[model samples]
Target: MNTIRNLFPEDIEELRHLLQTVYRAIYLYQHDRSARLEASMRAAIQSCMPFLERFKPHIPAYKQRYIELLKQPDRMAPYDLIICFDRAIYELHTRLKSGEIANRLPWSKELRDLLNERQEPAPESTEGDDAADTERVDFLTSGVGASRGEAAGVARVILDSVALAKVQPGDILVTPMTDPSFLEVADRIAGLITDRGGLVCHAAILAREFRLPCIVGCRNATQVIPDGEPIMMDTTAGIVTRIAK
Candidate 1:
């Protein structure tokens, strides 16, 4: 940690990478409840603090904040990355019908390092989204921003490009999460809602890039909200409340 924090220079990607290393095995250990993983991640990060403190050239604010986190102890959880990843892997297994695949575990080079030698970036995230699960309900919500916005509009849930091609002009898109693959139709949409990731997730990034209203991390929102129902989303407030329209 001291080596990564001090010698490596400070940056988001480096911090993200270091975090992946410290807590790489979090998802691999399946416990009774979600809280276990959350707590475990906090512990993992907390365990790195002493190393961070050893940097003699640290600035005042950085040192102060580091000391404060160590003081509180319980405030170390990184929700967006830590807990979300755990839930994401669990969701992935269920969605992929991952049965023995999950048990056997198909990991990438990064994940392998995290699990094997603790030397590389942990797998950023594994798949868990299937917004096209027509077996569920969807709420169309809208807000000022993409990430953390409320659900709204015509819930246009599609599996892939073929289904994406069928989208009507003013529909709200809902996806497990989006990659660069869906950008071609960005202008035709009113908004987006997602179930697999948080405000910092991919859909949020694209929404910002395209100036679109969107929301994410609704957590099985596809299963709870009914299709065609209008919603009031407040991204800043991290809310997606329902309303009649």
Candidate 2:
């Protein structure tokens, strides 16, 4: 870390390149793998504080370098980059400030096809052709039941945190996973379904407290369940059913 921080003075371009490389991994890992990588990175950044204390006076110089690079929209802001840096120090200069370290995963293209394709109303079937809009299985998929209960409500895919404000009472909150920030809107939703998590994750703890039905580790809930579609969360059986309207 000290060596990397030292590179900040070698040349502005080199520092920017290092920042990009670190953050790009965060961007792709969040999509392709999980948020745990981000969580770990943040933790490591926090660990660097003692070492960073000696460079306190030079922090502004480092930040100004980043600001100049960020002026080019192609270069992601350090905050949006999700690479580990001091949140408080960086927030002062970066436009992309965030308190939440881990972010929810969004629907993947492959999983979207699996859920939407089957539910799509088939074209009108002609003579000797397979019937269109044939009935499909009610339950879309299953996951680990984090909380025990059942809930039936419309699925609301929260691909971005901006949508948290729009969540309504009795709606099913579906996402890649939940972190501390998600609790802000947890009460409004009837249940929770996530693409990833385990028994110890925040979703499980919240479900138990809210007494809401919850299924984590679904792996594809976000892609499989379309926003505003009625879905049944059977936490007892760990199944999320997509109901035809």
Candidate 3:
């Protein structure tokens, strides 16, 4: 009763806002895959809890707060929505970084084992200003300096390796993030976009490798983006704007 009395509705407004956004992302990504989403959400929560216990500097503070608040007797205010969804996102990031999905992705082990076997460099594709400017109309939004230079093309959302044919030399590659498996076409692609990428992820590594325009940490980018639409991609500025032909 005391806690409820103490509460000001505004104190929780941000938390409520965060909850809506985070839940929406989860639903968008998992709506069709209920069993998988439930199991994955459970796994995600478990995976994040221990990271707080281990205490890494890289661990975001809101995550630590979430774990700590969950232990309290009285209700604490909710954190922001980014933190909520980030809990799951970070878990997925950790899993991807750990290489658990590498074996599951067909394009991975071969690249790993064949590092010495393959001598030919990844192919590079660059076009004139007129061509790139023309492709800029289709993308929705981009981040700050995600890729270098400019480009325009069809988008291929590479959430999983099952969609290999979708990646092509001129196609814009979008994914939650990239693992080694998505690299099979990295050299052949024009641009890249990701929802949860940092300097170490395959998206960054291969973007530099192929010199493709790349954007990282565009959360929920895949949700609004449609397939086969023309887009202008600017990786250096981390922007993806639509370019209608």
List the candidates' TM-scores in order: 0.41, 0.47, 0.44
Report the alpha-carbon TM-score of model 1 versus the true structure: 0.41
| Local error of candidate 3 at residue 22 (angstroms) | 32
Residues 57-127, model 3: lDDT tens digits: 33356444545543441232222322333443343334334465433432233223321121112223443
1-245 in candidate 2: lDDT tens per residue?
33322444444344333333433343334334445665543443334344334334434565544333333423443234332232322433222222232111122233222211111112233456322222347767778777778999988999777778778899999988765467688778999998986653446645665668889889988988889999988775677887778
Ranking by TM-score: 2, 3, 1
Candidate 3's C-alpha runs over 4 A off are 1-139
Judging by lDDT against the true structure, name the best candidate: 2
After superposing candidate 1 on the true structure, give the runs of residues whose Cα lies further than 4 Å from its correct spot. 1-152, 159-161, 241-245
lDDT of candidate 3 vs native? 0.52
- Cα RMSD of all models vs. native, in order, equals 15.2, 15.1, 18.2
Cα misplacement distance, residue 242 of candidate 2 (Å)? 1.9
Q: Where is model 1 poorest over a 10-residue stretch in terms of lDDT?
A: 114-123
> How would you encode candidate 1's per-residue C-alpha lDDT over 35-72 as one tens digit per residue?
66657655665655553444223323532443444546
Model 2 lDDT at residue 205 = 46
Q: lDDT of all the models against the reference?
A: 0.48, 0.57, 0.52
Provide the global lDDT of candidate 2 against the true structure.
0.57
Determine which window of 10 residues in candidate 3 has minimal summed lDDT.
114-123
